[model samples]
Target chain A: MSQVPPEADLATQDLPSDERAMLERLRAGDAAAFEQLVRDHGGRMLSVTRRFLGSEEDAQDAVQEAFLSAFKALDRFEGQSRLGTWLHRIAVNAALMKLRTRKSRPAEHSGDELLPKFLDDGHQATPASEWRDGGLAALEKAETKELVRRSIDALPESYRIVLLLRDIEERDTDETAKLLGMTSNAVKTRLHRARQALRALLDPHLRGGL
Target chain B: MLSCRELVEFLMDYCDGELPPEQREYFEKHLACCPPCVAYMKTYQQAICLGKSACKDEEQKPPKMPEELVRAIMAARQAK
Candidate 1:
């Protein structure tokens, strides 16, 4: 397993009772408590934002924007969900907005021109022969990673957004569906298809004989 | 016997623990007697493992929060 940093692991831990109490106080109009909440959840929010936006600069801006938005909407927070969940909702929206803005600008090369050509066959398995030659293993892995990223990026915007929010970010299905304004079944179907598409992209790189 | 496509779809939901108990019982019963589905399940599991390994290095790292940005946020909050 890849080693996650202790601080990052700590960020995922349940909030201490003291912190939760502070958050409740913040909900009751304590400015200091609000600041503490920012200090606690800011890193994790930025981490998630970076995953969505694919750039550090954009992630920072998104985190800042998300924090501001969260502060403004504090009154509306129902206190049913965890504070982290609420902040994450804000961060995802901020990141998606950034993506939309970037999309509006014409790209130097259209995505159609850069997409890989692959045959569609329900029965075809990835060739085991390609995984041989240990010397090329590293290069193959890099290519596979790029292929998976491209495959994900190729999904329809709605599908891609839901996949990122639900799978990569580890949001519960109900919360994800609510955030995307989708039914839970719709979210599940899209997620299943998204994983299938990703698997198809990766099939050619598997070493084990299929 | 479930076709390859149906098996794969069921396995997708199964692996995620999303299948309802009744549906899960049906799939498990089918898996008990079907050689091809069992083989297919192993391949699918391996494929997911390989996929994760292949992309593990590419996992995105969180960006460092700039001191200035943090300070700015703090300042903005104070002003508000």
Candidate 2:
């Protein structure tokens, strides 16, 4: 599947020498350099924030906040990774914090509450022989794409976040682990479980054809 | 010898090319001898293909960077 290459490359390539020099100038109170930095990273930041927050207003606010936060912390910029990755980290944090606040408000589970019951019994333990019976059939149907999308979106936030970062965003496992504060092994384990859950969700549709 | 269940557990890692080389070799041997495992692999490969096709639409469309919004952001930064 063709994906829009991550916007993170913008700062990775475009800035560097210029950005570091500009940042040095900003340290000396160069407001114009700071403005250039903002113009360079702002839209990409907004896009990443929007993917996580799912609201245009929230995304815009998050991007602004991320820039403000980045500016205040500019002295601490370690340059361990690309500026885009650094800024994206801030954007992701802001978006997640926003999501957490939204989750704090009482909300219905939307039937997702019942899924753990099925999962708890090790329904995931079903043998491959049994899985073969119908799993392929479900996948072949035209609506399978929509089903897969909804299934992914339905995953618990923790699993969904890891899957998106590790799989969809194509972040390296170690990078994802660092981003999530997890060990690489833990990331792999969660990713494996997440894929299993997705497979289970698709099974009913695929089973008939198998 | 890995049980069918154990093989199934490793199948996803296999598909992702995440399996360690030694373990991958072990699974390849198992696949060579096990018809069920081969079929299982086929099913998984198909699932991945379908999933990729499905997810492409979600990921490919570049997010719209509205001219007004970009202008507003640029303007705000300029005024800062």
Candidate 3:
């Protein structure tokens, strides 16, 4: 019944002693270790928060909150989880906390409109376009990456967060459902639709290449 | 074999490996014969990949970790 995603644990054993070293120092309340932890992990944590919060200021605040919380909880830390993984989980929670407090924006366009329409006869109403062949490798271009980011931002917050947590953050389905107070089935549906809607948003830009 | 629409309904569950054996067989069988559906699934999978990579720090913004944050947290760490 362990719902922790496998990716959440990462590979602590393979990581050189630098992480273990840091963990020990920080657990001892060594100030420099704490600072170094923030410095090393802060960029990634901020990126995680920004994906959820959108606003730069809120993202930074959330990262800071997560780090401070992690610092306070140090003695409870076991060696089983990677320092990065534990910090990543704390950062996700911090971002979600920020998300909970912020006033939600006005609802965007209908997600239903973004899904592929099927005919009454149970066939796709439209033909699939030929996407550039490299799959996501096509997104390696900086310009395309920006487009992907903009397309995600265009999604309504409700579905977008589900996509972020389940696919990007790689939380298990049950965990995501619990986080959003929905059932696992509901999480799966929303995650699918969120991916669909995001695909719709990207379709226009991809013209020949999503 | 499942129809295209039936397969569409199964797509998420299929990808999640949630489809039970008989249904899973039928789902794969449908994809086996249906090239359009095959293309659709590939694009869908790619979109997920795109979504996952969209927000990495390397993709957006400078690498600068905040200095103010470091100072604030360090001060708090020392105060404890």
Q: What is the lDDT of every predicted structure here? A: 0.60, 0.63, 0.77
DockQ of 1: 0.21
Stretches > 4 Å off in candidate 3: A1-16, B1-3, B21-34, B54-62, B75-80
Off by over 4 Å in 1: A1-17, A20-39, A55-57, A74-86, A96-102, A105-122, A125-159, A169-175, A181-186, A200-210, B13-63, B78-80
Candidate that would win on TM-score: 3
Model 2, span B1-80: residue lDDT tens: 65555676777688878789999888888788777567656755554455555555544443555556555655565666
Under CAPRI classification, how is model 3 graded?
medium
Kindly report the docking quality category of candidate 1.
incorrect
By the DockQ metric, which is better: model 1 or model 2?
2
User: Backbone clashes per model, in order?
Assistant: 0, 10, 1
Per-residue C-alpha lDDT of model 2 across residues A15-105, encoded as one tens digit per residue: 5787677668867767777667666777677767765665688888777767766766776665556676677678777776666556453
Which run of 10 residues does model 3 chain A get worst, by summed lDDT? A1-10
> For model 3, how does the per-residue alpha-carbon lDDT over A1-210 read when each residue is reduced to its tens digit?
211223333344554588878877876767778778888888777777887888888888888788878876766666457777778788888888888887776766767888888888777888666476645666878788888878887787888899999888888999898888899889988988998888778766664764
Leading candidate by DockQ: 3
What does the lDDT read for residue B23 in candidate 2?
Answer: 92
What DockQ does each candidate score versus the true complex, computed on alpha carbons? Answer: 0.21, 0.26, 0.53
Please report the TM-score between candidate 2 and the true structure: 0.56
Q: Quote model 1's TM-score.
A: 0.56
Could you give candidate 1's per-residue lDDT for residues B34-68 as a string of tens digits?
A: 66556556544543444444333443332345667
